[model samples]
Structures are given as structure tokens and as C-alpha cells.
Target: MFSKFVIASLVGLGLGIGVGSVPVLQDHLHWNIWVFVPISGLVLGMLFGWVQFTCSSLLNLRVSTRIAFAFGLVSALAYLGTDLGQYLTLTVAVSEPTEVLSGQTPIRQLISFPEYLRLEYGSRFIKTGTFGNEDVGYQLGQVGTTVTIVVDFLACFLVAFATALVMDDTFPWCQACNRYQCKTTSTKILFADEDRLYDVLDKTTELLLEQSDHVKVNAYLDLVAAEQYLVKPGDATQILSVTNYACNQCDNKTMVGKVLVKTGKNFSEAKDLDFMLSGTS
Candidate 1:
């Protein structure tokens, strides 16, 4: 994220300077024009990050490819929003104050790429100078537009990469753990089905074995039986579950009871219960 932001910002600033002014004295241009001109380039560059984070958070999506795509798509949409914002400003400028005051607030219409590109260069070039002596300004405007497009595209790619890194640990890697050795709250909360949860609970028995300063692990169900149940909230779709987990590590072969709760779009491990199975298999 940092790299993309820095690189795009530099490119935008360079383009802003390169295209906003004219060259004088052979390849030398006055540095005066750049003092206040690259503000849009810099702000919009950082705005992309905020846009991605906002979109991802609103959806409550854990770090994943889907959320990453959502961020990139929204960032592109925001890029277009800037063009819409520009169009609205121009629209209000050309309309009378009476027209603006009456009726409703003006709705901004999104502009197409070709039209935006055309307007961008057209506005910059046409405003640079009066007709005949504007060739240099026209060329500079074209260069600036090209640079802007390139920088925007590069920024999009970088935001996608950053999204991947930012969201990588939002969800558990359920497939990596063997059923005989582990279970996760996600099996009850985040996942779509309960079969995997039951399967893991039924099979989870073995853990790390430490013997004579050497430790090894194996997979086997414990020699005990357990009871499980699903709890439901009143009129709400809360999917809660209680399970008596057989813990072989205990010297008395004591069982552990686990409760899981699903709240809205999130899942959590609830407080442990005193309930446990009494008999050993």
C-alpha cells in the first residue's frame, strides 16, 4: 500500500508539473507553477486507500479475495465519482442561480471515459492560451492526460495487492487443520454447514504426545462418548451449539464443554460450560 501510494503520488506530481507549465530556455521550466498545482493528484492518490478500506469494512468481510475485489471495484467507481463531481460543478456553473435554487438539488451524472478524457484535455488546453499560440499548451495537456490515466491504472493494481495483504488473516484456515487434532469456532459460526463441525468434534481426540524429552503427534478419537446440541434464539436466526469435547490430555479423562454463538454476521466462542460427559467408552 505504501509503495503504491508513494509511486503513484510521485508519478502524478511529476505529470502535473510536466504538463501544467511550458518549457523555457531549452528543457528548463520554471518551478513556480508546481508549488500549488499537484494538490488534486496527491489527495486523490490517498483517497483511493480510504475508499477501499471503507467499502471492505461496511461489508464486514474478513480478509479474502472477494473483499479485495470489492475494494478495487469501489476504488474505480470513486475515480469515476471525481469526474461526476467535475461535471456537476460545470453544470451548476452554466445554469442560472434561479434554476439551481428552484426544484431539487442537482443530481450529478456520471460521465464516460472518452468524454472525461476529452473534457480534461480540452479544458486544460483551451484555458492555457488564446487560440493561435496554444500549441505548446495543447501538447502539454495531452501528455498530462496520458500520465493521469497511466497513474490511475497503476494505483488500482497496487490497491488490489494491498487489499490481499490487509485481509489475509480475517478468516481462519479451516482446511489446514486435521479433524483428529483440532476444531475451530468458525466451523460453527463462519462456515455454511454443521456437518464439518460434527465430523471434527467426533474425530478430535489426539494431540501432541510428549515422552522422554521427545514430542510427537498422532490422530485418534478419545475413548469416550459426548453429547451435542444446537441452540436457537427467540425468533432470531442465531445458530448456537454446545459440545462436550473429550480431552485425552487430562489425567482423570475429564471432558470439556464448548459453547459457540453466532451473532449477526459474526461468530464467537462463548463462555465454557460446566457440563461434561460422565462415562468413558
Candidate 2:
């Protein structure tokens, strides 16, 4: 298709540009002014283009400029998001507790004890040379640093280009979507007599929970428990049927009703039985 061709061309162009910029990037990676940084985008473009061409042909989709641009944009955005996410996780170094004084009396005497305390939000405190009079309050200000504007713009451009090349509406598992979705991998592609996907999910969830903070673990445990109760083992037919049946009920009442109708009053035997899972009914 014409669209496919455009995608291919743009990807090729981007890849060429990126390949052209590598030496420049190498030169500036260690420099003071970031002179060679511009080439990173070009390199990213070229690499994205090659990937797009290979995958597009496999999927039987035509390469197009629109596709390339869309991929590029998405890729750039994904990179940007990842960068920001890393910054958020890593920027804060140390935190300490501090108490604030409450209201004082008219005579300049202390009226009440401190009601609350503040802790640094993973931000660091720096020690600079003391002045004639040292101010303790000014130390927290040293922690927050702003990311450069040039870096942000470059990230966006790369995201847009990469997104265009790699995204496909049909693939639900793609990270391009705001929701947590995953594409069906080879393991999931072929249907077998027994389904091991839940086993995989269980292991993955366990690993994730082990690494998560207290608050996150609590929330994740609740969700994982709920999901476990809803899932059943069987062939694809049973799995699909159960999934569809659960999805169709609008509320707890509806879900209960559906289960009763389908399971012939065996719903009482179900573990972790909750109407909330079916829907709002």
C-alpha cells in the first residue's frame, strides 16, 4: 500500500540520518557544551527505521510516511517517559525529619508544642561553606534540579519517530498504550491442552511484590488475590468462556445471578466469592 511505502521511506531516511550522526555523538558525549548530542536523534531514527521495515514485512503491513512518523513520535514519547520515570525514582537521595513550631503567645512565649513534622521527599541536603550566620532552613533548596530543555525536546522528537514505526493497533500488549497490556508471545500464540499463563502470572507477580515497597505490595496483593479467585484452569474454550462470562456481568448482583444461572447454585462453593468482580450490579 501507499502508506506502507511512506513508512518505509521515512524510516529509511531517519535511519540514514541517525547513522550519519554517530561520530558526532561520540565526540560530544564527554564534552562540556553537548555539541555532539544532536546526532543521537539521527542514530535513533535509523535504527528505528530498520526495525520498522523488518517487522512491517513480517506483519504484512505496508511501510508509509505516516507509519514512520507515528512510530517515531511514539518511540520518542516512550523514551521521554522512561527518562522522566527514572529521574523521579533516582533524584532523591536522603530524607530527614524536621518539626515546625506552631502559634506563639503575644508575649513571645511558646504557646503550644509542635503539631506536625515534615520529612524530605527523597531529596538530598547539601553542606556549603557557612556564612557569618548559618541558616538551617536553606539547606533543603539545594536538592531539586531541573532537567535541561534541549534534552526534553530531543526526547520528544525521538519518541514521536519511534512510536510511528513500532506501534500497531492490533497488538494489545504493546507498551504504547496507556493501559497495562501485552502482546501475545509465542508461548501464548499456540493453544495447548493446559494453560500455564496463570502460573507465569503468579511467578511474575510474586517477583514484583518481593521487589515492591510496602504500600505497593499491599495494593498489588489485593488485586492479585482478586484475579486469582476469578481465574479457572481448563483448555482455551473454558478459559475464554469464563473470561467472557465474567466480563459480561455489569455488577456484583448480575455476576452472582449469572454464576447462579450457569453453575446451578454451585456458586456457594466458590472461594473468595465476591460480586464486585463481575461488575457494579
Q: Which candidate ranks first by lDDT, i.e. highest?
A: 1
Q: In model 1, state the lDDT of residue 198.
A: 46
Compared with the true structure, what per-residue lDDT tens digits does model 1 show for residues 132-174? 7544334446666555555554564456446544534322222
Candidate 2 yields a Cα-based lDDT of 0.36
Worst 10 residues of 1 by lDDT: 210-219
TM-score of each: 0.33, 0.25
How do the residues 1-281 of candidate 2 rate in per-residue lDDT, one tens digit apiece? 55665555555444434533344333322121232234444445445544665556544564445766765554454333333332222222224423533232121122211210012223224334466787333333323411222453365456546554455432222122222122211111111222443453354346444553323433443454454454443322212111111111121111110111124322222222211121222
Taking all chains together, the TM-score of candidate 2 against the true structure is: 0.25
Error of 2 at 12 (Å): 16
lDDT of 1: 0.38
